[model samples]
Target chain A: GGIITQTPKFLIGQEGQKLTLKCQQNFNHDTMYWYRQDSGKGLRLIYYSITENDLQKGDLSEGYDASREKKSSFSLTVTSAQKNEMAVFLCASSIWDNYAEQFFGPGTRLTVL
Target chain B: GDQVEQSPSALSLHEGTSSALRCNFTTTTRSVQWFRQNSRGSLINLFYLASGTKENGRLKSAFDSKELYSTLHIRDAQLEDSGTYFCAAGNNAGAKLTFGGGTRLTVRP
Candidate 1:
């Protein structure tokens, strides 16, 4: 049994502001991922880390950046916020690189004013 | 880029009813996984299939590697089953998963 904790269940930001989201997992998983979900849309990959200090860009990584400072934690940063932007940021971790099941965080809902 | 598509973007069913959700892949995939998003915004893994079908309780899933598709079936629906369901395919080249738009399901009393 393991837990994936995401800080700040809700976040609010102003246009052009930078926002950061944090995720930590005690599973000691080797892979971590960041995904963004817009209203009425599917989840899009933003970033993924195979191991500590390793970063890979996803389809939606143009305006986002990610860091895996340690094996247990991964963070996502929004370079600039868009007005009225509302979405949920989801973090997931997997124990293996194969099509293994991923454990997800509770998620952080973000609103850009 | 690899692609995934879910059928019936939204669904509603009465208690005791049965339904199936499908995910189609644009390319041959290494594996597939199913998930259900709860009201609290937590994605819970329902099934992980490398190939063939697997069942647990009222849920069943099947993955076709060559055909590039997956299916999830729910029997005797319950209110607690209401929410969005997603299926993601893992690519063999790098093991990166590409997710579908998801299916929003509602089970009514």
Candidate 2:
């Protein structure tokens, strides 16, 4: 039973400011994902990494950048925050298999002013 | 475009009642996963099904790849079950999960 940990439970950023969120997983999984959740909506995938230093863009990756410097950690950077933007960013990890279930972290709530 | 559609965007149930959530995929999917997001924004995985059904405690989930759909049944619902529920469908390969809009469940005592 491993856990996924995300840093900074809450974040407040100004428009055009850059912010970064970090995630770590102890599951030793080969895949990590970043997703964005808006109020009253489902999650949209931003980026995913299959292995260390490997990155793949998802449906919503245009405004974000992701880095997988190590196998156990994945990070996301918001290039330029949008004014009045509010969303929760979630990090998840899964094994390499096709049927593996993803384990998610608590999430980081981002609010842009 | 391949998409996942979930029904009953919101639901209100009294404690002890039972209800089900459903997800339909536009294309055939290899598997389906169910997750519940708590009030504090933590997603708890409930089930992952490649085919047939899997049961855990009071929750049971079923996935039918041929039918391109899945269902989640909650029996004797409790107040703690109140949260947003999401279903994601994965392609035949690794981790191409597309999520549904989610159902907001409010279980009142």
Candidate 3:
């Protein structure tokens, strides 16, 4: 019954700029994830964290960096925004070892100018 | 080839009508999850099934572990049912879930 909150619902940045997105979950879940979704497409996992200060790279982790500073927060940074990379970034969390279900946050839309 | 494929990339139906969306996996899947992405970009988890079927209100979902497919049936659809539906599947021992291209549903009034 907890919520995941992502800041800056909308973000506009220039190509090559480094943009950071923040996510916070109060669900006390042990696993957190970051995913990207193109318009009319499925979600792609970018990065995930198993616990505090732990990070794992996903299929699309290149050009992206993630950090779990605390158990409650996970952050994703676009190393160099690509003009064609405008998409929504979604944050999700799940209980440890519960890969079956993950709760998602209201996504953050990013547009590279 | 896609590890996961969702059929009827888009669908439109009148309110009170019914329709079903399907997801086919390339290999056996241990679990499947269904989600609805609202227009405002919030994803709501609809169902998570390891096997068999589950129902909540007007939505029913079933996962076929052996057939590598899953189905979501919406009955007596309502206007609020309009959204992008997605299915994600994971193998028996993996934590990663391969996602299928979503199905866009528009329930007309």
Candidate 4:
């Protein structure tokens, strides 16, 4: 079985700082996704990539930028972090099928001070 | 707007008890997926159903595309099952998934 790995299990950033989170998958999946989860809320999609160098915005992509430089890796950048913001960012990968299940990595917890 | 709504935002169950979680979609969806998020914030995929029912271990999940709803049943719950459970729906032939608010399950011994 393949695994999805996310870097920096915890992150602490100052206001207006730009923080980047990285994800890597060994599943050789064709689709990768970025999602944000706040306390007491559901996961909201930020961005997704169908292939290398392809990007698509999601419902919550206004303050985030994503890059898929290679097929096995996807990265998300938080542009100008909001003060007192606390959330967990998750990375997931799935095969290119309508019924394929998306596997997720252990999230990166972001805390802005 | 296409949405997924989950019932019983929070639930508490004693070990060995059984319960069910429900997800209702605002529109017709192609498929549904269930995930369990552990305390450390890792999401583990449980089930992905296009239709009918699927069972794995002590968990059983059913999806009715015609009714725009899904259900997840846990039998003889264990303490290790304490976590947040979420259901996501896919409307089209893409990778986008709309997630429900999640049901927080606390299984106490």
Best by lDDT: 4
**Which residue segments of model 1 deviate by more than 4 Å?**
none
Local lDDT at A16 for model 4: 99
lDDT of 3 at B34: 94
Give the Cα lDDT of each candidate.
Answer: 0.90, 0.92, 0.91, 0.93
TM-score of chain A of 1: 0.96
Residue lDDT tens for model 4, B21-55? 99999887999999999889889899999899999
Please give the TM-score that candidate 1 achieves against the real structure.
0.95
After superposition, the stretches of candidate 3 with alpha carbons farther than 4 Å from their true spots are none
Model 2 gets an lDDT of 0.92
lDDT of 1 by residue, A1-113 (tens): 89999988999999999999999999989999998988777777889999999998887899898999999999999999999999999999998666767778999999998
Instruction: Say what the RMSD of model 1 is.
Output: 1.5
lDDT string for model 3 (B1-109, tens) is 8889999899999999998999999987888999999889898999999999999999999998888899999999999999999999877535566789999999998
Q: What is the lDDT of residue A112 in candidate 3?
A: 91
Q: Please provide, for model 4 over A1-113, each residue's C-alpha lDDT reduced to its tens digit, 9 standing for 90 to 100.
A: 89999998999999999999999999999999999999978898899998898999998999999999899999999999999999999999998775578899999999999
Comparing 2 and 4 on DockQ, the stronger one: 4
lDDT of residue B67 for candidate 1 = 87
Descending-lDDT candidate ranking: 4, 2, 3, 1
> Better model by lDDT, 1 or 2?
2
Query: What fraction of the reference structure's interface contacts does model 2 contain?
Result: 0.68
iRMS per model, in Å, is 1.6, 1.4, 1.7, 1.3
